[model samples]
Target: MTIEITGSAQWEAWQAKVLPPVERVADGLWSIPVPIPDNPLRYVLVYALECREGLVLVDAGWDDDVSWQALTDGIRTIGAHITDVRAVLVTHHHPDHLGLAGRVREASGAWVALHTLDAAVARPGLSPEERSEDIRSHLELHGIPGDEARRTVDLLDVGRALQSPAPDVLLEDGEEIRLPGLELKTIWTPGHSPGHSCFYQPDRRLLFSGDHVLPRITPQIAVYSQTAGDPLADFLRSLERLETFEVDEVLPAHEYRFGRLDRRLADMTRHHIERLAELRAAARETPGRTAWELSARLAWSRPWESFDATSRRFAMAETIAHLVLLENRGELRRGADRPVRWYPAATI
Candidate 1:
């Protein structure tokens, strides 16, 4: 299956060609693949670390059997049992990475750790008031239509049902977590999510860069929660911070591990700038155009791309977020009316 990204053709092509490979690169580090069938571009990489204390797994695989079996088999090859895993270090609260945490813990009696920002969402129990408040606030903040918001919230069942329990421990930046012999340092790389953190092993020059920095494509960093602000600004800052690292190899949650960290970062940075420029150009053409209108006007040549309502909504909201950020940066201006909003290019 071929996946299509609105602004990235090359990234889509790379994703189409690469096969998920499980390789043991170091004594304690193993890379396992979780191929996503629905979308070819969506692949999750779970790292297995063997320590003196016990086995430490980073980012649990998907909820399905194929992913679980593949992970278990990979562990067996390394002479590690799922039962021996003493701890599960979750990179973020995304379902793909956090789905199997409980099952893995049940199998291995391992403790689960996540960032505090994500822990709120990853937590299992919520009062009806809390749930309603979360949904209403999130939808209103994002400017999602009421009907669509209702449907989307109703569809959040997958996350609620499949997600493991709330993380027992919270990971903070610069904090080092040691599992037996191997040690990994937590580096806060927010923007993709409020609590996104990537683990870095300086000795090996390996960075487990969750969704913060992918090999080929830029991750979606937008305002989705109740909190409202310029998330794109945060994302740009995170990218700048990632560039300072000596990342010889990046084990991204999605896609293959490769070199050229500086080059990739530069490419991603340029991609964002170019996207902002595109939005500016679009705004200049038709001042005070709504975000949805601008999204429709943006170049989309691929016919095979997913055209479902959810996909359309995500694409439009993402466009609006960048526009909003540009507006905040004085690069654009907005004429707002609640959900129906218009943006224009700011004067130079």
Candidate 2:
């Protein structure tokens, strides 16, 4: 059978400007588009699954008054109310996916569920200074200069406002959610984030991929101080995991739903392989360089100098992920320095 990308045409048309209309995707599934402020991706698709008791939302859109209103309005269109939402299943702690979760719980007394690892990050207890310090330390370790690292921390602080409420239920990998009327199993795909999860309904052959897989763009996978292991490796493995599923359709958080899971997975895998080779070649040319410097030399969607603080930080992290992978594979080595440097295993 020829695999195909399937989703509401209207939703695909309004990529980043106007919000797409709330769409009934499946028998009990509804797709609601909520806008993300100043983001090129435009909006998140909050999937609401109807149940015996009320409704269970796969992910909540960004936390803001506009998003809140949009969510409520979208719910109303489905003959339901925000208060009818019984649970919010957060894919990860990213603001766009988990932002309004706390607010939803406040209004509806809904239980918010997240993977234990991400729950730690989303839980609200850290002081602003503490968060800032963590960010600063992580960036500095990745070879970012002190001042620039501090500035990046400040930029990241803006996202703190969108942190979701503490998770009421911590989900585990391969665990089936006990929703009254649905059978959704969590797949732990930890690359985009330590505990990023995708929900699969085996009966329906539907996968609710939250940034783990997107229809168009390859989800950003980067290394951070908080990251447990080689994120690039984890990302590649997660892509392979998709092949095990006989998915008829995919419902992603950012982009329109699509079929051909195997094809997209191959594309994502090839992307990283090419990125790894590029980094390896760059390492050969510049014998001993920090990830930060190497990142500046790599090709990005935009010029390195044109990137804002957050974008630069993400790019640096991505470079580091690739570097670490290369080092682990014996293609590169890390030098002993305060801000560690990477060198080709075989000197040019």
Candidate 3:
């Protein structure tokens, strides 16, 4: 069953499909709804934790003026200015999560902290050519034609990394946040991103599930230039780690706050199992077909042709992630060729 906090303004706003009002979740803790431009998720909930020195934020929203305004204005609700923010603990390197950390640092001299692995590639790389090559290579792996892939790469929004600057501090798993009046521990959950983390406040019994877990929509786990091997396996193992946590409520990066994380984790796992089964069937029916070809046979929220280049890129990456997982499980064999194809391991 989905867990909902009793009479939460966030829940009401979620139902209304609008931005939730700023709420003081617990003593010395506040949740701010900062807008994300043109995203269906609407807003990212930036949590401000009070300390003797000043306020420390869990995540910052997008770098747009509107998002910055919402973040600053939300901070004002708790009688603090943007300048009062002393530190920012980033959840991951996503534009929606770590975008404004630089601006926040400029305004408040706040130190930004990100996981070591994510910090390595979170900053904008030096060469666009390298990025284009990476995109071409990625597309080729999924059987996208060279000319078509080039055109698609030209249109894809690959500049997202520009908003995420490097962090001031590199975080490690199980490390305690030493800010006054709080006890937040970093839980390294590498799946959604190589260095995604969830903050656990043991004293308050709250878990800040940054994109690692959400109330509704499943977090996208896809293969990309920054992604390492078998992200699906990493994601499932991370879920198991989180299942051991004892918490009263889960404060996700997006969506409203909820409880019963165990159920959510189980449901996400089941969703992946069903998805993998569908992909397995598709592979069996069209053995030796490329991942790109098999992707059309799988289920998606919308029709395949309706997806634009960026959306299709995400879909293809997600499909590759699943295919790679199946291969790792010894259920499928990947062809050793450019524009790689998949075949059933049992038949091979």
Candidate 4:
């Protein structure tokens, strides 16, 4: 269950109290703080790129006065104003990524560009037909009750009401986007989200990795909908593909930006494999058990306890996804009851 924060003004209140003053981290890039209270993951990073055509913003942060101010001031630090922004590129549809998109567009008249797949999720103001029922089905298959599943879906509204206009440009995988002075290639990296794309600059050997690959933590991979294929498997394959690219430094959405891309990629790849092993061991001892039961066995951060329904749903979906991955790899197996999945260490 989500720990609901009561007060309509709380989101804005926390933003004003915690948003850090804007600072430029690179010649053409800036880091704007977006603070979230009652959660450990507290900040969002906004990258601003100035080109002859104008500015290209990667990831629109939270929709709030503080967040807007932080972004606007950060842009001004490089001698550019919000009105100078030419276009916005969304890494994904998550609230933190698309929050200020509308405001940015309104202020600068910038056209928004996002992957078509992710755009579907950011559209929450529509009727039931617009939303995917597959998300609910995925949760139910993992043994989450109807009421809990419904509540989780409802919490998606937390950010929906704040969504900006749909993308002015629909991005496709493998498309090369050239905005006057910038050359960015869209690399389709599913798993985190169906159509999540990472922007890569071949000449600079730089990667703008949204939530695809973080500096410190693993991006949550789960079955949110009747999403195509195995998400965890897709993620592993995506990591392998990323190693093929020559990324000298990665600019992630959270945490500090760093160099040595291969090592960081290796670290991320190893984490999931090791996690799969741990899940295998845990399930071996318990054998026939439900996904929910196994989820309780795993350790989560203390701060996660206060996360809302959307967060909890992500946690549970990720847990089930790992278990399913192991099962698919012959490391574990599911029984007739569906919920009764068993992990036999000997099988591995």
Candidate 5:
């Protein structure tokens, strides 16, 4: 798909790295562009669904004064106020998606919902020490060096900024969102996060793919302490499952909307396949290299040297995911060292 099918005057605005105007997506649906400060993803499209009681929001924007104002004002453009919101359906536990949920609930008295798995992580259940330890363990496991590892752990709190509020409602996979006059079904698509979800409307034939599928960017499929094991495998399986849906149009969280779900799914799968092949080849050539070393060698949107502390941690996480997937596939084997290195499975 191209920008020609973006379906709104959002192409130039997107390229210029500016917020696009809120637009009515359909007769009963409205898309509100709420700004996400300092992020490459300039904004998140919070979809408003008209219902008998009031309005149901697909996702809340980031939790900040600017983001809140943009969200509230965007709702106003749709002839409603934040207080008119009946519920907020969050796609995942990431701060950008789940950040404003609590505030929205407080303002509108709306019930906020998330996948049960994500809700567990996003909830105020984990102590600060516990979270910090998790980050430390994740970095250490991925072979981040002493000083750099500490710096990255410190940055995870301040730089990445994880402040997901507890959700009111917890949903399971394949569960239907019980909103009046809305037939949205929650499709659990993990990998980006342990419990990322996409909402689908059978009648409307529209998929609200929240980071599960994007027009241009592939969502970061990283593995951290919370997301241990083979995340790449989970990501691929989820992509295959989504191809079963008969989607006419797709409304993504970031970027603009588009169609051709099958094509997008195929392209994303192929992209990951290519990355796996590259990693396997690298393992064969180099023999045993730590995840961090292998990660810096992998292709990224930007140069590895240009990556900041938080970006390196995320890059390592994704690299570990691919490495773990390769190990599971018997293409690579992990060497039991302090920081763990990978080798070609056949050679091992």
Candidate 6:
């Protein structure tokens, strides 16, 4: 029988008005909720695992005065100082997870660790002009108009400014981290980003699933120039890999902790399957359409026109991901035109 995972009661209570309480999650382990501005998810749960040296943070919240103060105060509640942090294990290079890593390192002299793949692109050592040109070319390749693509490229400046310093330690898949009292093993579960990871503690039957397998929201697996080919396929395989693990509780970066890893994994997998089917149908119905047009045809949380530039960019990337998968599976074919179009593959 597949078990269902109802999330943490304490977290659900605070979802309405207040931040979740900081509590000891396990022996020498504490959960701290740090606020994120203007986001519905509200906060990122920064887990502090204690050791003989000090605390090691699983992920740092956004970098800003508000988030910094919240993280520091939450750590204080657990009887430790932020300066006492020894290392930071980043799950990915997303702003909410890695934004404060540099600030934390500056204060604590802690080593920030990331998978080698993420570390390479975390901060592309390029001049502003060069980076803008790269973004423009990439956006245009995805069928976005030049003017709109330039605007999108300009919007990305904020994200580039927020990137943390290069990682201090480069981690490998399945490599055991030699912390003082923890047996955390890195599981490289890419596709959310090329190097997204989940840390596992087999003895505790716990998994620190970054954005790989969230309880409520399915992590967006979009295809971008930097992203690996067929990201949705990679995401599906990664989900399948998690089904083999025996996990009692899932500690995610966002939302509340939950159990029943297998059930949640199945739900996430089925979601993509349905999405893929939708994309395939969209392609068949509107033959010779670009990913941009096909994406607007699909259902979204809100109307495509209502989306901001960043959201539109992500939506297009996600559309391209589905199209790439369908094309690879012989369900669709790519046209050889500028601003390339997609067509339903001829039945064999």
Off by more than 4 A, model 3: 5-7
Q: Residue 322 of candidate 2: its Cα lDDT?
A: 91
Worst 10 residues of 6 by lDDT: 1-10
List ranges where model 6 is wrong by over 4 Å. 1-10, 158-162
Q: Please write out the lDDT profile of model 5 over residues 1-348, one tens digit for every residue.
A: 332255556656787777888999898899898898888898998999999889999999888999999999999998999999999999988888988988999999999999988877675456677778777876887689878888887765533344577778888899987667777899999888878999999998999999989888789997777775677888899999998899999999988888888888888998999998888888888988899999888888889999998889888888888888988888889887777888988876
Q: How far off is residue 296 in model 2, in Å?
A: 0.9
Query: After TM-score superposition, what is the CA distance of residue 160 in candidate 3 from its true location, in Å?
Result: 4.2
lDDT of each: 0.72, 0.86, 0.88, 0.74, 0.85, 0.85
The TM-score of predicted model 3 comes to: 0.96
TM-score of each: 0.83, 0.94, 0.96, 0.81, 0.95, 0.93
Candidate 4, 179-271: lDDT as tens digits = 777889999898898778899989778788999887667898986554556789988888888988988778777665667667777888888
Q: Candidate 3, clashing residue pairs?
A: none
Spell out the clash pairs found in candidate 1.
Answer: 52-180, 52-181, 53-180
TM-score leader: 3
**For residues 155-240, could you state the per-residue lDDT of candidate 3 as single tens digits?**
85667665467799999999999877767999999889888999999887799999998988889999876578889889999999
Lowest lDDT 10-residue stretch of candidate 5: 1-10
In model 2, which runs have C-alpha deviations exceeding 4 angstroms?
Answer: 1-3, 124-126, 158-163, 346-348
lDDT tens digits by residue: candidate 1, 133-175 = 5765556444556776667666554435434567888988888
Could you give me the TM-score of model 6 versus the true structure? 0.93
RMSD of each: 5.2, 2.2, 1.5, 7.0, 1.8, 2.1
